[model samples]
Target: MLCIGFDVGGTNARGCLMEFTDATAPPRQLAEVKERIRDTRAPSQVAAVMADIATRLVEQEGVDPAQIESAGVGIAGQLDKTGNTVVGAPNLGWTNVPFKSVLVESLAGAGFTPPVRIVNDLAANVWGEFCVGAARGHQDVLAVYVGTGVGGGVIAAGKLYGGHGGKAGEIGHSKVVPHGAPCGCGQRGCVEAYVGGRRLEERLTQDYRAGRSLGLRPYLPVELRDVDHMHMDAIIRPDVADAAAAAGELYADGLWSYVADLLAMAIANGAMVLNPGLILLGGGVLRNTKELSRRVVERIPSYILRAAADDIEIRFGELGDDAGVYGAALLARG
Candidate 1:
């Protein structure tokens, strides 16, 4: 049977098509595609986008619709235990939508009537790693992926552990400070609010404007406060060589330490509560900035109980950008 997996996030939707002949056979990847949804908030629009993706896969690969058996979709927000209702995805501007049914209907119209199953994106990630990626063979595991925002999942006693309402493992939403940076979830003090890529960029930009002394050329406005102008040009004093070099290191260290501490706290809390056998970390932010990941890894043990934290393994996720897709596909197989 053919199965499909879709990973829908605030910025993009990625899908993969698979063919499996038997329960023991390794899945054959038939097609992979990535698309951007123009109207993420509308379930109908999202369904249409997914429908198109499925149709293209079947057609391009010369597969009959009847061969498709099931589909699993992962999303970056909360869902009911049944995984059919979108409780609330502030980033997608969606709330209480019948996502699974809507998507099934659209796919049916496109010559595919496969059953659709959905789960949180982070859950998808942890499952992928646990089954075939870095955390493979591990029964108790935790995964936190840092991207445009943060999302994570936990596995306990050999099963994916979603709390009663399926909103467990939301480490990103935990408040890091009383009234810190605002998060995309419309709240403040979240770990994501502090270290998310976009938020980090915005914070650094604001810091430079506020005179934190980074090495980048300063932007000065003639009419703006704390800005000076000379004739037609606005000028700021150039930082001395040593000061500029030191400032650059200071700026970077300042951001990394803050991010590391925030992650450490979240990891420690999750570890103390779950005591997973392994912790898998991944995503664009972690992939690109290795040292940040290193810093967090180094700082995590300090945040948790001595014995519990000592033995648990911490490793980067191995699936790269395909984690959600692989996990979703695994879910579809079930």
Candidate 2:
């Protein structure tokens, strides 16, 4: 039976049809599709948009809707499993929205009654890794995903650990600095301040403003006239670039250093008291993890028990962005 996996991101919803084969048989990628949405604040509208896409996929792909064994949807926000509602999603301005019901109803409307599973995006990513990606065959693992925002998940003995209230893997909100830069979460110095895409742009934007004040950097070139603050916003002054790059590099280093330290602290303090066999790191930040991983791995030994650190292997995520979808499909299959 074919399973459908859907990744409901902030701006786009992606769907893929996949079939799991033997351990050696490569997973077949049957069909893939994407749908973009404006992400208006209305939860009903969001649900409608997702429903429309799922409906179209069924029609265009020639896949039997009823033959789809299961469907998994991954969302970014606080999920109330008991209520099946998206309790809060700051990015989409959603609150108490019945996302699961909406998906079920939408699929039912299209004449298919397959079970649908909904989970947090990071959790899905971890699920994907645990099933087929970096953490495959491992009983204990930590999957850290650094994208526009940072997120993480933990798997203990092959089962996902969804803590009380399901807020387990919210490392993005973990405070790195007290009273530091403001975050979209209305807090100061959250990890997002230093590493999120929006936050990275903010840093460069601030640098541009500073250089403008000092009259040391040229204004945007004619070609950059149409560019927004984010695109083409790096500190361009040769001297400024050097200084800013130094600062940016420091800021990046400091943030990751703090992340590594805090992660180690969490492990030392009890998160890893059991000593996970592998620490699998994935996400956009891990895209350039050579230096960061080395730094973290080097410092971790100082924080944790030597024996525990010795057995830990830190590696990059191989599934890339599909971790969520693949994992979600696994969720639906289960």
Candidate 3:
């Protein structure tokens, strides 16, 4: 059966139509639509955008909308189960919006109909990894997606754990410093505050401008492209490349140290408590997967019990930008 997956991120939304065959067969991306929102979109407007994207996929791909057996959305926001509303989505500038109702109505208006499921993006990400990506075959796993802000999802005992209030696996908020930098969530010392891409750039920017370090301010643009924040490399002007390389290395070092320390603590604690079989890391930061994973792995010994850590596998997420979409497809399949 054909399934539709929509990965609704903060900056943009991507939807895909896929034909799910089996566990091993990757879904075929029959059609896709990518749209960027200027952050001024209202809840209803956003719903329309999502509907339009889905409709385009069906029409462009020549697939019968009704043939879509199931559909799911992975959104970025705080969810209110009791009210069935997205309580607040700072990124989308939304609050107290009935997302499901709006989507359902929009689909109905579009003359396209199907059973649809909506979940937080992180949960969908974990589901994607567990169903067909890096965490496949594992009963217990953790998938962390590092982007503008770090986000995480946990699958325990073959099921996605969304926590009591749909706030499970908020690993980004895990405090790394007792009293460190400020975070969007209004918390201090969050792992995100320290290791998230924008913060990393800010650190480098401040350090470079202070004259306390090398005048490597020129590389900021190229190095700061991953998830809109400090990509490993972007070939640009020669001077920019040189500056970016130096800034990138400095950013990477600080990022690694912070991630290794906090992630290890979180994983080790989780290992002792939940004993996940594997931990999968992905997202923009993993653009330098080899370096990121190696550093994190090296710090495992200091955090986890030697015996428990021995059996655990720390791996990079196989799916790249497709992780959320694929996971959303998994929801549709189920």
Candidate 4:
């Protein structure tokens, strides 16, 4: 059987075609395609881009569209209980959008129809890691991804736990400070407010404009020095990490270190509560900065309960950028 999976984000939508037999066996990737999202305001537009990516993958693989038995979408957003509607996606500027329906319509229009499963992107990532990546043998796992924003997913007792509202693993929104930095979610002091890539860029921009000397400023483009906000073309988390890494001693006391500390704190708090056997961290930030993971690991024991910290194995995700797509496809196959 064949399954199609998609990982849609604010910047791009990636889709993959995989062949799978059952849940026990791993899926084999046949083809993958990615499309940059030009317009994210409309759900239909993004759905269309995903549909096109799916179509292109099938074509690239020379597989019959009819061979696809199921489809899965890992999207960045808060989903309703049914998982059909995106309650809100701050990065995409979406509110109460029937994303699954729009995607289904778009796929149908593209001459493809398959039962689609919609899940939070982090959930898909965790599932991927659980099935075939770093957490392969772990029954209880917590997966956190720090990119444009921070997101988390949990697998408890060998099953995905969605909680009463199907939003169980939103560790990003966990409050870190009272009345601190503002988050895109319209809240204050969220872990994401301090560590998310977008938030970090915003903070850097603010600090630069305020005449605060930053180690990262020299590494940034000259034009960004006078900019009010860091645009897409400006320096990102990976660039910032590189700059910090280059400045040996500064890496320890720089903004990236603070970001790592807060993220570690959030992860520790989550570990104390969930007590998962494995804690897998990934996403653009962790992937780009290897030192951040070590820093986070070093701080975990201090913040987490001793018992919880003792048994937990913290590691970076193995699947890199393809975790979501692989997980989504396997989940759809099941």
In candidate 2, what are the lDDT values of residues 1-334, reduced to their tens digit?
5777888767877888777775423257777778775545466566666666666676777777787888888888878855388888767778788888877876787776787888888888888888888788789887666666777887888888777888777766767667877877888877666656556545646755553322223333446545554344544322232332334454444544655565445434333455777777766654654455455556656776776777777777788888888888887777
lDDT of each: 0.76, 0.67, 0.72, 0.80
lDDT of 3: 0.72
What lDDT tens digits, residue by residue, belong to model 4 across residues 226-280? 5554333454445555555546636334766777788889999999888999988
Q: Whose TM-score is greatest here?
A: 4
Question: Candidate 3 has which clashing residue pairs, if any?
Answer: 219-244, 223-230, 224-230
The TM-score of predicted model 1 comes to 0.85
Which has the better lDDT: candidate 2, or candidate 4?
A: 4
Instruction: List all candidate RMSDs to the true structure.
Output: 5.5, 4.9, 5.0, 3.5
Best candidate, lDDT-wise?
A: 4
The number of residue pairs in model 3 that clash at the backbone is: 3
Candidate 2 segments whose C-alpha is farther than 4 A from its true place:
23-26, 39-41, 208-274, 288-290
Q: How do these models rank on lDDT, best leading? A: 4, 1, 3, 2
Expressed as tens digits, the lDDT of each residue in 40-99 for candidate 3 is 377677778888888899999887778888778888876775425877877787888888
User: How many steric clashes does model 2 contain?
Assistant: 0
Off by over 4 Å in 1: 20-27, 39-41, 216-248
Which parts of model 3 are misplaced by more than 4 Å? Answer: 215-255
TM-score each candidate.
0.85, 0.80, 0.86, 0.86
Tens-digit per-residue lDDT, 64-167, candidate 1:
87788888888977899888899977668888987888888898899887677899988988887777778877889988888778878989887889988788
lDDT of 1 at 306: 89
